[model samples]
Target: MRLNQPRIKPLSPEGLTPEQAEILAPLGGGGVIPAGPVLNIFRTMAHAPKALKAFLTWGNYILSRKNDLPPREREIVILRTGFLCKSGYEWTQHVEIGLRCGLTQDEIVMLKTGPDAGWSPADAALIRAADELNADYFISDATWAALLTYFSEKQAMDVVFTAGQYTQVSMMLNSFGVQLDSGQTLDPDLRKA
Candidate 1:
């Protein structure tokens, strides 16, 4: 773990209330997502007791399933959102997953900047939508309409949810200085301002 950073405090099942316990139990299961800062962050939400648990639980669902959108599209949305936030932790983690969902190294590289490096119309629209949402908490009607052709009603909602989740994640990672994986680096543009 990096010094002076938001390190993953170890996960222990003890001292948890039934409510928080039910919520946290799955996080400890490696099959779910492996024990890491991401899950640890969610676990810390338990600090707020029952009140914050609702938000935390809903967040886990939306972020993990995102069933409305296809994996490829959702991954694109997430990576672009992460890039817009200049979130090293988010970028490092998602870049690999994005590739698994068929995002090429070039596509992931293009995500670092404002959707201007010659992305396809749909891809460009996705990036622009995230930028718009980040700046305004809402996407432009034009971008929304453009995405409707490719994304379903549920997917449309998922796109926004996924974007919003990563935004929250990026803000936490950047402000908290969650270290990028040791010895691994992302694209230069992704690390660029």
Candidate 2:
């Protein structure tokens, strides 16, 4: 959504090189070669199979159960980071992911409003941590202390990891002009960006 057209066009099925196809194999297997519509992010990332593989490996950790933060809390940090980065594509994609992870639509909307939008103290700490990470590249001691009150040290570390990962994702999506996938509608707040 950052640009009218993608800076690097996502490869079509016919255009995929063998390496790209292998990277995208999980999406479609056997002889299908990307069976369904690939999300713009993945398809675009496929352009660099090695990098895409690396991205997915680290990304898997952040999204996997291995992460100390629960799924809902992870989504909160991701959504907050996407919003703070003004990444419309990220916001659109993760809005669904956030909802599936137990974040209400109202909470997603509230993320755009700021960190103190009536979230519980623990959730507020997570949001503030994302905000601080986005704005200052570091979370304050007070915010860290707030987070420790409700989450383990490892969970707190996951908070930074999740926020940092999504921050990088948002930057890539915005800079690359990775648009929303099919059936996605842009949030009005990000229409200008």
Candidate 3:
């Protein structure tokens, strides 16, 4: 699949465009292009580009909201979603973000198989919920009840939003073939693990 570029790409940044740079300005003070473009490709099928842009804007709002879930828990959901979707771009990007949220090298490595990572009961349950939601579009009753023991109504809603939003990002990453930049690659050990 062709990525949205016409040049032999550099690795670290892949193909981030000026438009991408402009759109991602507020997120993490800007590093890589935000995932919006990849996500927007799908929206483009049925609407004008302007409307698609608006859709991505609101989607980013969902991602940017900082609710009760610490960065680590949130990143856990994102990381796993990326893996499931085989979204190398999203997975590589979140490996860094996941670390900032306090995931260690070993912990980040383990997130590819979050359920088997031997997380705390609550954390394990959260990962399970994410897997279920991604694979089936709805959380299982057992997982939902487990979540209730940890998160309040609003916080639970945010967790759902976080998972759903990142899953969308992952879908775009795969569909768009959004790869790591030319010189950049996902950590070798990470790729195999």
Candidate 4:
């Protein structure tokens, strides 16, 4: 995505240390090492096994039903954040996840355009929140009010949480040069010159 190749190379599967294996284990199959190919993001993060473990714990919570934002809404924040960050790898990965969470392909394309792309009021607020968080690191009072109109207090919090989490993820994917996985294509808009 950001760089043509990884600045920090992913640990080769054949050469994983026990710590790496342990960290990567849960991401793939049930064993200490995965049965199949581990996703690129997980593999790259395995370089810091303890950190990856902690990251996964928090990530699990964010993706779980406990986050208050529904699955589709969460994906909207994530996709919008990824798009704003121009994180090609993050965008590629989450597009599929967003689709699974019930965002249509049209909605996915609309995410790239912004909050004004004919989104429903509730959806527009989510996108605006992500856009504000990315640009100002704070949602404006008007946008906050808009968010409150549609979301519960906890759901509003999750909106901020989801955007913050993906912002960090995008930074990592970009800075670490995490590439798209096998058969994944880079979004043309994200192509680096």
TM-score of every candidate relative to the true structure:
0.72, 0.94, 0.71, 0.95
- Please rank every candidate by TM-score, starting with the best: 4, 2, 1, 3
Clashing pairs in 1: none
Q: Which ten residues in a row have the lowest lDDT in candidate 2?
A: 27-36
Off by over 4 Å in 3: 1-52, 187-193
Model 3: lowest-lDDT 10 consecutive positions: 38-47
Query: What is the lDDT of every predicted structure here?
Result: 0.69, 0.86, 0.63, 0.89
Off by over 4 Å in 1: 1-4, 7-25, 28-56, 64-66, 181-193
RMSD of each: 4.2, 3.1, 6.0, 2.6
Extract clashing residue pairs from model 3.
10-182, 11-181, 11-182, 11-183, 11-184, 12-184, 14-181
- Which is the leading candidate under lDDT? 4
Task: Find the candidate with the highest TM-score and give its number.
Answer: 4
Per-residue lDDT of candidate 3, residues 1-193 (tens digit):
2244313222223444555544433432343243433322332221233444675675555556445676677777878777776666677777877887788898777777668678887778778888998889898888888888987767677678878888777665555455564345665533423
lDDT of 4: 0.89
lDDT of 2 by residue, 27-92 (tens): 542221225677888888898899999998889889888899988899999998998888999888
Candidate 4 lDDT at 181 equals 78
> Can you give the lDDT of residue 48 in candidate 1?
53
Better of 2 and 4 by lDDT: 4
Query: Model 2 misses residue 43 by how many Å?
Result: 0.9
